[model samples]
Target: MSRKIKVLQLQNRYNVNASDLAEQVIQGLPAERFEVTTAFLRGRPGPGEPESRAARSIYFGFSQSDLKGLRLRALWRLYRLWREQRYDVVIAHRFKPMNMLMLLNRCLRIPACIGVQHGIGDFDRAYRRWEARRLLTANWRIVGVSRAVRDYLVGCGAGFDAGNTVQINNAIDIDRAERLQHPREQARSLLGLAREPFIFGAIGRLVPVKGHIHLIEAFAQVQSVYPQAQLAIIGEGRMRAELEAAIARFGLGGKVQLLGAREDALQYVRAFDAFVMPSLSEGLPLALLEGMSGHLPVIGSDIPSLRPILEDCGGRIFPVGDVATLAKQLGAVLNLDAEQRRAEGERAYSYLRGAHAIEDFRLQYLQLIEQSLAAERAAL
Candidate 1:
């Protein structure tokens, strides 16, 4: 009997969405043909948090300082772990872990190495590009979570090209996501929201990149025209104070609500009348996909990552960081009747089912792994 292929999936930290994505990779591979191990360089699952679902899991417990600068000690520990396990394939997520493996794999000579890029501008530094160009070999492959990210990698002159880079859109398990969501009336009650308002909801960190300020500004204009219009932002961050100040400045205390971070935030999405994602940038946001899975009419920025998905799915898009345009789009969605809005949302759900289904994501990843292994065998 052929020996099962051993795989290592390394992540910098334990994040809810990222862990779920890794779980998909673990479950996608056939048990008879492969064994997978997942490792986190820092942080572990806290109480009530989900843990890795790989056949085996490891937590390095490295502090922030350990991974900074040259990361010599971290590298030594990872090298020892790699040599001991002797994995047939190594999959690293994001920049730090990928950079570490890129350097270590040169000495360990892993048969196949896959680096997953979750966002853009990760290779903006000259040194990172130089390292990638020098250390990458025929055994290496880079995956971008979205086509925009793939294009950025290929165009950055950082050793990644069309042949070495592939686009795999981030996906959610639709059945599980939808099942977790509460009914509209129940969800609104859970969020302490009134059923009377036409709520425009958003889910993301309250960071500048999320463009919440612009959303608030636009909503300020929106409420003046449609006094019943309300905005609810879910999630908390350092920007809370700034966002609160803006809410005060607009005198929108009752209209704009910052519903601080809540666990399983997606479960309450039904509380929204329409979903909005005004991100300044993204690498195929899973939140948007989650919103669509709830069958909500969505609006997003005109940035490359969101434009194609929104346009293709029959959702709305406005110029990034343009408050005036964002307000205009919000008003447009408000103009739609209940039936028209439901139809628009159904179109998005249909598009998501066809394009970003978990089954397709799993198949594509499995195919990539098998092809990478076959190429390694040929090289030998």
Candidate 2:
């Protein structure tokens, strides 16, 4: 902790989870104690924004697919740049270059290397056999955002040191989400929602793994009984045309709206009676945490990572693709008495603030960073 930690996060370029987390970390850091710098694989900060106090935010690639052919080329460029700089520590995030960095770290002896697990990916992830084996056979420290993920690594025999695998839940900034002081009616009208129907919403990039199609079908079943409840999904994804077509096919056009990703994610959440995340997989979803922070009780798919987080809140969980069960859970929650619903929202919000607020997460990052640095020096 004596030297200013210079962290080089090899994460995504589109400013999603990793970038968003980095931004909050900069804003929340005890500036006097930390100096941060970054190297991403995409776009630059826009228009003189001081998002990071680092000397610069360098881009190595702009899109996920861009890394395929030029990965080695990108690493050669990054290594040259890194060689000129002396870093106290380097924490590489997920995949490609990060994996590449960890694989080559022994040769560099970069002092300390940390790898953050984004999720307990599906069976398909076994393809990273060499990298997984390298982690088991090498000296890198591993961190998972949720305990479920940590357990998965241990079960897989990833060979992390006994104490090297740490569980750090992703954090949320409750204050940011709390800004939605607008009345529910106002939120509904603003989002072009009917003034009186029950609103059920979910947010995430519209990918197949997100389980959006199942949610659409589940909501359709729920509307059969209430006819007054509506589902609004907020996110931008390649599946828009297909999702829209599915909604029409279900004859739920009047009951569902696909509000593609928005500037303020909570704005749409504020209009919901309850939020839903039917993800087949996740890394401690930010959407569920944010929705709950906004005091919207949630219904999630029963996945290993999300189950433990939701079970305590009277959160309802159904089988991954069970439309009947999912619809039943949604209907039951929406049918609660006004006081009961308010109490549930309050409980959900309290759970979020207690365990997952943004400030809490920022502090956790600093602690982990400082701890990793200390561990290195202690060994010396």
Model 1, residue 233: C-alpha shift (Å): 1.4
Q: Which candidate's TM-score is highest?
A: 1
Model 2 residue 185 CA deviation in Å: 1.8
* Model 2 misplaced stretches (Cα beyond 4 Å): 1-3, 16-19, 43-53, 62-71, 122-139
- lDDT of each residue in 1-380, candidate 2, tens digit only: 48665667666563633336666656565766665567777766666544454545666654555567646666667677668776666666665545767655655667677777767752136556545666442346777777677787667654554577777777766775677535688877777888877788898888898999999988888888888888898898988988999999989887889887776677567788888999988875888887887687789988988887888666778988888899899888978988988888889888877877677777777787777677778877
RMSD of 1: 1.7
Report the lDDT of model 2 for residue 360: 73
Q: Residue 57 in candidate 1 has what lDDT?
A: 84
- Candidate 1 local lDDT, residue 308: 79
Residues 207-227, model 1: lDDT tens digits: 889999999999999899999
Q: Model 2 misses residue 7 by how many Å?
A: 2.6
Candidate 1 weakest ten by summed lDDT: 14-23
TM-score of each: 0.95, 0.88
Best of the candidates, lDDT:
1
